[model samples]
Structures are given as structure tokens and as C-alpha cells.
Target: MLKISEDKRDTIIAKLKQDIDAANAYYEETIEPAVMERYAIFHADKDYYRKMFPRLSKRCEITSTDVQDTIESTMPVLMKTFFGSTDVVTIQGADGTDEDSDRAEKMQELINYELQQNKFFMKFYRWAKDALITNLGIIKVDWDREYKEVQKTITMDAEAYAQYRPQAEAMGIKVNAAETNPAGGINVTYTAQELAKNRPRVMNLMASEFRFSLDATRLEDADFVAHRKIVSIDYLRMQGESGMYQNVEEVAQKAVAPHYTTLDTQNNEYIDEQPNRTDTGRQKVELYECYVNLNMSDDPDGRLTPMIVTVSNGVILRCEENTYERNPFFVLSPRVEPHHIWPETGFTDLIAQVQHSKTAIIRQMIYNIAQGNDSKMAIDTAALVDINDVLNNAQFIRVKGNVSEALQPLPAAQLQSWTFNMLEYLDTVKENRTGITKYNQGLDSNSLNKTATGISIITQQSNQRLELIARIFAETGLTELFRFLIKLNQLFINEELVIRLTNGPMKIDPSDLDGSFDLIVNAGMGAGAKQTNLQNLQMVRELSTQLAEVGLSGPQQWYNLAKRIIEEVGFKNVDDFLIDPSQMAAQMPQQGEQETAGEDSKTTIRSAITDAPWQVQMQFWQKLGFDVTPQMFTEQVAQKVLSSAADAQAKADASRGDVMHDRLQQANLARPRGGGRMAGTTSNAGAQAGGSTGALEPASQYNGTMAGNAAGSTTAGVSSY
Candidate 1:
């Protein structure tokens, strides 16, 4: 820690104050006015008009609600696109090692758990809405330890109290009461402010309270970033007492009044404009938590150090070097300009002019219709018998002069049909600007072209713009937020964080999460894209099934396919539908073993049935729900067994023949030699008496040549006579 003297602190504070002034000046002059304009339009519900209407006419004022319509209708879609699943973001392992993969997974789980605990959904909702409306949204992420007060009432006897007294004192328990009962039991009522929790926090900061350097194009490149807020004097005192701040008592004594900016006034519908005269401790002071690089003149090393400075009423409440490696603020924008950090125009901003044009056209149309429905009459007061009756619109009007000449109906202008055409044209313009149409909002009843192809085209085109916005948000702020979270866990977390996941309870140790990882945000593209993805996944499943039939795929592959399909269908917990291959692997047999076991079991049952007595076999078949006699069953089984045995014998004989042929070829004894003659021969007379064969004769010549060959003898071709 770099210590600063009083003079050096004053000099640094002055320089920061100058920077703050310049930043605020630019914000008020440029960004704030535009924000105020959009804010009014988005929340516009009252009647508004640029000029007064004529007397005794319909002065009905109308304000177009297209701004609100565009924002509210688009918000739900963006929310669903980002938060449709539990894995809002996923982690990819660095270096592709198994340990890194495991670490990445555990880190992701821990980050997601922290997000859920901090109510990240609401924070994201607010942040996205701000960006859509104001062209910029910011969130602050930090690590902090917070203490929440807890109250408990314990009933203990005298002996138990003696045992618990020291523990209660250590816990800083404030006793409210101690009552003794007749049953020799005492009830102890005390409040223990000891629920100290340490975790990462995500806070959605209002645009009005955030400021940054004006000359920078991005937050990372900015020289200073500050969150201007109002805190009570007592809050500062408490922080000081906790040793988190210094010189806070002096600042609290001179606490300044809260200064509400123009944007703040617009955001707050009903704000009190009074200063606190009494209760100085409860008075609110303007506090600017500025993160900047300060180079003090104290002269150890003149280089700049990243510092977190807390300023209120020209006094430094706290100043220290920033321990978190990076800045804590993350900004999100749907659209960006080439040369500036602030977005060019938000969704509402682009359609603001269209809203104004439609409001004007609709207002005129209403006015013209009113005049046409109730036209004014030209009456002569001098010839009128009762002017009061004519003025009161009485059914009967008495005129002394010629009725036709005395009372004449004035022609009021009828509304032009082109005005309605102009209104419709403006609606089209609004749709084109914001990519929000009736089709996207589920109001496609009036569409002229209702063909499936046309509808799909429209849906895809509309969703492309939304998908782009989602991609921007996911890639920019969301990724940075999770990265910051990982860094926080690495820096502050020491013990294991036990989180109950969808599969089961998992313990993530800090040491297990030490690595570099890549983040992937799981943002749904759109309905059209999702449908396409689902089709693709289904096709993959078909291919996988085919491969499995041919023994190319296994249980693990099937499990992965099934898990992916479930996730694509918007279900996060695949365990509810399918068992994991890893867990099932422990209890299941190999594929070949399973098949062999199945066949053996069947054969065993059949043999047991065959060997049983007649009565037992009959009873067994009866118990199996087969209505058959023992003889019939036995005959069927005998035939099956015979067929099986014959097939096995034929296969064995064929295999042996192949092996013998190969051996004969290798030995060059397949063909007859020496003129194809046998070694032993005799004359015709000797041959007639008996059979004097040179070699083994054929089976048809009354010799057992085939049986000898079947017995693996080599006397088939040259047999003994």
C-alpha cells in the first residue's frame, strides 16, 4: 500500500475533481438531454399537443404509445433469448486437458451459483432495458463481505446457560430478555448480528449515476470511471468503524446535501426537494466512488497506481490501491458507433420520429371526425325567437323569419382517407426501424400473405435483427461479467463451495478452479433458428441410430446425442430423462458379453424344461401361460434341438473342409502327379476278382473315402487297397 501525506492527497483530489467536472459537463450537455427525451417518450401516457385547438371543438390530445410498445414487446423476447436455460454461459477448457476441462466445468457451476444467489435475472433485465432505452447500460461486479442481522430466542436451563454463556458472548449476542419458568427452564431472547457472508456481487447501476471520461472510445481505454451515489453519514461511520475507510468521521460531520441531476429528476416520479435540517447522521451526502490511476508527488516511484478513491463534499473518505486486477464495471449496448463508446441510437430512439408523425396524423383524424359528426350552424340572432333554445340544441327550434334562410348548416371538413394511409405508412417505417412488427408480437391476423414460406421468411428476417442484438450482448458484457467473476473466485475464495446442481450436489474447491478458460454464452438465436437447430439435432440422431445398428456407435455416443437433443429442446437436466453412460457403465455388461449371456440363459431354460419329469414339464408350461400337453411341448423342443444341432455340425464340417483345402494347396498336393496314376495297380483279371485299387477309390466304388476324409485322414486320394 502506498501511503499519502495530507498535501499529496489534496493535490490528487483536486485533479480528480477537475476530471469529474469535465466528465459531468459532457454528460449533462450531450448524453443526458438525449436520455431525457427518450425517457419521456417511453413513459408517455398523458395527453400532449404542440398547439391549442379552436374553441368549442374537440380538443382531445393524443400521444402515440409506439415507444412503449416497442420496448415492452421486445424485452420479453430478449429475456427469453438470453435466459432460456440454466447454462446462461458455459466454459471451455484451456489447453484441452482433462483436468482443465473438469476445472472449467466446476468453475462454471460456481459462477452460475453465485449469479443465481445474487438475483442476476433481475439485474440483467434492468441492464438490458436501460441499454434499449438509453443506448448504454452498465453493471458493477465486485467481491465483498456483508453482515446480516439475525435474531434468535433460545430456551435453556441454568446448566445449559452456563455452558452457552461464553459462546453467546463471542457471537456478540445482545440479550433482549431472560425469563424463568416454574419448570426450571429459562427462555433466552437475543439478537446475533453474525450472518457474515462473502461472495461476488452484481449490481445494476442506473445510467444517471454512472460517469466516465469523455474522450475515450471504450471503458477499458477510459482514464476514469465513477459511480456517483448518495450515502447516509451513518453508513460512512459504520464503514469507518469496520476499518474499511479512513477519515470518514470528518467527512460525515461536514456531509453535503444531495444534488439531484436533471436525469435523476426525470427518473424519480415523486421526489422530495427538501434538505435534512436535523438528524445530521441520517443526512444524505453525495459520494463519488471513482476508479482512476493517480500519480502522487510523494516520490517513492513516480509511476501511476490504480486507486479507488471515495470523495464526498470535497473530502477524501477513502483512498487505496485497487486490488482487483481490472475495473469492475461492465457495459452493454445493442448497437455501437464506429468512433464513440455511446451507441448511436437505441431501438426507441430510431422510432421516436415515427411515433411523433403517427400521433400527429391520428390527432388530426380524430379532430376532423368530431367536427364532421357535430357540425356548427349559422344562425341569425335578430330573427331568432329563442336563441337559448338554439344554443341548447333543443329538438324543436322556433324561427320567425324564413327557416331555410335563417338557420343554415355550416359544412365541416371531412377527414381525408390519405391521412389513414399516412398513419399506416408511418407504422411500416417504425417496423422497419426497430425490426418489431405485428408478426413478431403474435398479431399476424391481418397479414395479406399467410403462406408458410412467406411467414417463415418474415419470421427469419425479423429475428435476424434480434439475434444480432443478443449476440452483441452475449459477446460483450455477459462474457466480461463471468470473467470478472472467475477472477474474484480465484482471488477471494479459499474453501470449497458446495452447490446443488441438477444432477446432484457438487463441491467446487478453489484449487480445482485454477486455470485459464474460455466462456461461451448460450443465447438462443430465435424461433426460426431454434427450429432449424432442432431439425439438425434430429437428423444427427437418425444418423447415430443407423451407425449404432452397424456397431459403429455405442452407449456413450447415444447418451451424448440424447443429452444434446434434450438441451436443444430447452431442457437443462438430461438426467431426468436418460441415464448417464458413465454411471450405467459400472452396472452394465459389455456388448458381446450381454449377447452371449442372453443366448446361454435361453438354452439353460430350455434344457431344464427338457430334463424335467412329465408332470413337472406340464406344470412348468402351464405356469408359463402355454396351453399344451407335455408330449407336444417335448416334440417341439426336440425338433428345435435337432435343427440347432444339425446347423452346428454343418458349420463345423464346412470350416474343416476350408482348412484342409488351404493346407493341401500349401503342400502342393492338391493335383495328381505322375500321369494321374495310382501307386498300386493291377490287371483287368485281378480287378474283376476283387478291387485292387492303386489309391483310395471314390465313395461310389464301394470304399469309405468320404468317411475317411471326414475323419481328417490323408488316404482319400492315395488309399490302401
Candidate 2:
């Protein structure tokens, strides 16, 4: 807590007030009219009717909420694109784009783990987006200690005091300095209880917190102050950054709401319970605290440029002048007016003008018709009790003479055809200016029925207007958010953060993370991405298939592209929504084995089996120890039984012939040693007719089929010799 003199505090308040007053003046003069009109559009009641058509206000109180509804309709689209349900922010480390590096990988995991624990995107992205669209979007990077000493009330007797006081003091517990107690020992707060075995080991953990601020309530635009270089600004009359921050806090204290927290769930029946510090009507609110950032400082690089002041209950709770090594706040706009500090245009701004015109014309027409419908009458005053009661009731005139009254009709008023034409023109203007229409807004009517494709094409073409705004926001706001997260990592995280990744778990070592990476915004990505992505993936899918067919891509590469395609189609990551290619490793034949076994031979054998009946294929495969089923075998499976049997019998005969020939050769060699003369070669005729066992079976055996079916049958002439 920094001290400020009474005189100085008043001076600081005066200075802050002066700036606020001046800013408010600018707001009221230039921007307030449009904002008030927007409010009228939102309310769409008497004020609106008066604003649009003063004369017709009493007659027709119809005010359309089209603009407000259209604006709201854009929100979900923006959210889906901005913080896509899949991957929104990518972690780029100081070590360049190589995500495989140790530090880079760890940093990515740390960010992921933090996001999972905090749900910053899930909870706050949409709120911030709303702020961006109408007002100013902001983000703050916070780093606070996760661990705290337990605060428990403990009573001590003299004996317990003697034992506990020494131990408590050793553990850094502060004791109350009361003089003496009427009781033997004093009751005091002991904060040294080390949560231990009584608590399960898993329970011993610290949960980090995430919070987002969508405060644009009292905010006067920052770009106005910054770009205008609003000079002659008075400071809080402090010496340094810290002192100035303290003064800013004083200002915020006066502005923040008293008993700010509502504590809606503190007493809810469905909500789970937690230890809470509660007051009577409004509880002690740690979560509902508010913040103000004065980002008008001249020095862009110096500390306290965007000074932070936090307050609750009309008192300054925290004030600090620091940086996230970069600006902590991010500003976004859906559309910006040219040469304007703050964009005064929105999706429905122009629609109001048209709506007002249409309302005035319709109301005037109704008024004219009503006046004409009330036919003028020349009734004698004596005939009626009162002139005011002339048309009050259907009266029977007492005059017997035929009333020479003719039902004269006023000249029929015809609305010009161009009135509708002008209304159509106005409608066209609204569609042109805002890119919003009944068709795009999903308003159902017989007159306007556009196909979704036609509507989508028109919508996409119209998005060109918003795309530039989004690009500008991405460049400034998104980059700042990345910087904020990096600084938090550097300041708060000390333990290794485990983040599950596609390859494996990456341990994000905060100390090793060097936050230096470019923030790249893909124009083809985000809100409009879903449509373009589908088209692109369709094309890429074809190209990928062609590449695979041409042997230019491997299975792994194909798999990676497939995962991306899955995501491009707005599905979750491949790991969650798509089947993993690696999961089929067990089912696939190993590379070496497949090659060594000769695929050509296997293909021939498989073809033969495939051409056979399902039953026969199953029986043949069963003999070969293959688990084949009738359902599993396709028509491609052929003559399995006949092929396997013939091949087996042929193999058996070849083996027997080789064995007999070898034995006969050995006998011939032995006979020669016993002094038998070597007969040159047996006459071809002798072996042809009745030959020795070792002699060839002429050419007949070699030419014809040697073996019969493998059911132990052989051709009669077929000889093993």
C-alpha cells in the first residue's frame, strides 16, 4: 500500500475528473447522438416512434427491432470464427516455427493446459466479441500466486499453546498481540496447517483462475485519446508510476459499484458447495471485482502506459503499473467509419433510416384512410340529442320525407405506385449499406424466399465489408492477447505444465519458454472459413487422392492431410472425431515380411482362392492356418480347393523324384568302384520302353501332368523314378 497525503488525494481526484469531464463532452458532442439512436432502436417503443415519426407517433407506435436483432445474429457467426470450437490460438515460441523443439513444444503444451484449466475462450470470447462489435474489446493478462496458507480458527489451552505456539511460529504463523486472555490461552488464527495425509494426495493441488472483463460502461474511446494526442492532460500529481497507479485506484474506487457482487449461486440448491466468506446481503466478492485501464499514456514503450486500477465496494483494492512485456489490452471493431476515432456504423444503423421512412408512410396512409372512411354528414342538429352523439349510435331519423341525401363518396385516394417503389429503394439501400436482409436474417415471408445457397453467396460477398475490420482487429487485438499469455507464463508458472499433443505429452517448462513469434492471421481462416474450407477441402481431397495414386504421397502424409480435412469441415481434431491411422498397425502386415514373402506369389494364390466357393476358400485357408470366413471372402476368391490340392500333389512328386535319383546315383558310383565297366549312356530306346529305376521315364512323364488331386491320388503312369 502506497501512502498519499490528503491534499494530494484530492488533487488526483480533481485531475482524473477533469479528464473524464472533457472526454464526456467529446462523447456527447460527436458520438452520443448515434449511441442514443441505437438505444432507441433497441427499445423500439414510444421514444423510438417519436424519434422516427413525430406526427405519426400517437397514431402508430410501431417500432422495429430489426437492427438490434440483426446485430445479435452476427454474434454467433463471429464467435464461431474468432475462437473456433477447434483451434483458435496457436502457440509459437521464441525458437521460431519449429514446434518440435524442446522449449517450443513445452510452451505449446503449457498454453494448452492453461486453456483447458481456465476455459478463457469458452467463457469469455463471445462477451469480448460483443464488446468489440459495439464498443471496445479488451483483454488483461493476470499472474497471481496459486498457493495460499490455510486460514483456520484454533483455540489453545496453556498446554496446547506452549506446544503449538512454537511450532506455529516456526511455520510463519502470525500471532495476535492481545495483552492477556481471561481464558488460560488466547484463541487466534493459525495459517500454518500443511494440508496433509488426512487429505488425499490428489486433493493437494492449486487451481489457477481465469477471468475476463467486458467493461465498456464508462469507457470513452482510447483511440480518440491516443490518435488525437490529446494534450494538456493533468496527471494525478504523483512522483512515479506506482504513485500514479495508486491515484488511478482512488478514482476507480469512487466509480465502482458498492456491494458489487450479487452472489446468485451462493444459496442455490443445485450448485455444489465450496468454502465461502459471506456477508449479509452482498457477499465478500473476490470474483466480481472491476478494472479500469488508462491507456492514454504518450510513451508506447515505457511502463504504466496502460495503467491498471482495480476496485470493489467503492474502495481501491489493487493498483499496479506494469506491463506484459507488451500491451495487455486488445481492442477490436466490427466496422470503422472513415476518418473517425470510433466507428459509429453498425450492421443496422442504415436500416433505421429506412424503417423510419416506411413507418411514416404506412402511418400516414392509415390516417388518410381513416379520415376518408368517416363520411361527412349533413344531419340537422335538432334531429339528434347532441351533435357529438351523431355517429355514436345507429339512429332512425324521424323525418318522413325521403331524405334527399345521397351517399357521396370522397374522391378515391390512390397511393402512387412509386411510393412502393421508393420503399423498395429504401430497402435496397439498407441491404447495400448493412449487408443484412430479411433473407439473410432468416425472416420467413412469402414475398422473399431465397435459396440458402443464394443467400449464402450474397452473405459471403457482403462479408467483404466486415473482413477488413476483422483483419485490423486480428493484427492488433489478437497479437496483444498472445503477448499477454506469454508474459503470464514468464511471471506465474513455475512447475512443468503437461499438455497432451498429437505426438505425445509436451512438458511446458515456463523458464525455458522464450516468447518470440510472429502472429499470423490467415485471411482464409475464421468465420467465413467454414464455407471456403469445405470447398477447398473438396479440391484438396481430389489432389491428395491423385498424389497417392501416382505414388507421390505416403500413408503418413495422406493421414495428416486427412486430419486437416476433418478439421476444415468444422469437426473436432482428428484425435477426437476421426479414426487414427496408427490404430491399424496390428492389422497391417509388416513391411519387411510382406516384401520377403513375395507378394506376386501370394497374389496368385489369393486369386485362386478367391475364385472358389466361400465354403471351399474357408476350408483351404483353414488347412493353411488362416482364419478365413465365408463372409470375409469376396468373389475375387477362386478355386481354393482345386488349386491347393493340385499344387500340393505336384510338389510331393517332385520331392520323391529328387530323392530316388540321388540314391540311384550313389549306387552307380559304388558299382563302378567294384570294377564294373562304365556303360557310356543307356540307349534312348531301352530307357524309353523298360528302363532301370534311375533311368528317366522318357519324355512322357515330363511332358504330361505328373500328379493327380492331392487326395492321395496319382496318375498310374506317373513314376517317382
RMSD of each: 12.7, 15.5
The 10 consecutive residues of candidate 2 with the worst lDDT sum are 199-208
Candidate 2 lands at a TM-score of 0.57
Report the lDDT tens digits of candidate 2 across residue range 1-721. Answer: 4354555334434544444446545554555455445555654556758865676877766654555655665566656666663544555554455453556546545665565556555434543444433444443434533334566766667677778778867876876542236766667665554422110000100001112221233123331121111111122213124242233434423432222111223223433333232422221223112223443334556443343333322234344443433323344555555444445676445567766677787777676666667646666554444555445644643432344432223454666678778877876886677655554455647425667677667767766544555566666556556556655676666555556666567665656775565444565654564777777777877888889888987777778777877776766656775555666665466765776467446445555654566688568656754433343343112222323444565566567898765665455334421112111112223323322111223334433423332232222111122
Candidate 1 lDDT over 603-714, as tens digits, reads 5665565566657766765565544344444443443354455456556656779875455444433333222332222222323232321221333542454354444422
Candidate models: Cα lDDT each = 0.74, 0.48
Our tally of clashes for model 1 stands at 2
lDDT of candidate 1 vs native? 0.74
Give the TM-score of each candidate.
0.75, 0.57
Error of 1 at 308 (Å): 1.1
Residue 348 lDDT (model 1): 74
Which candidate wins on lDDT?
1
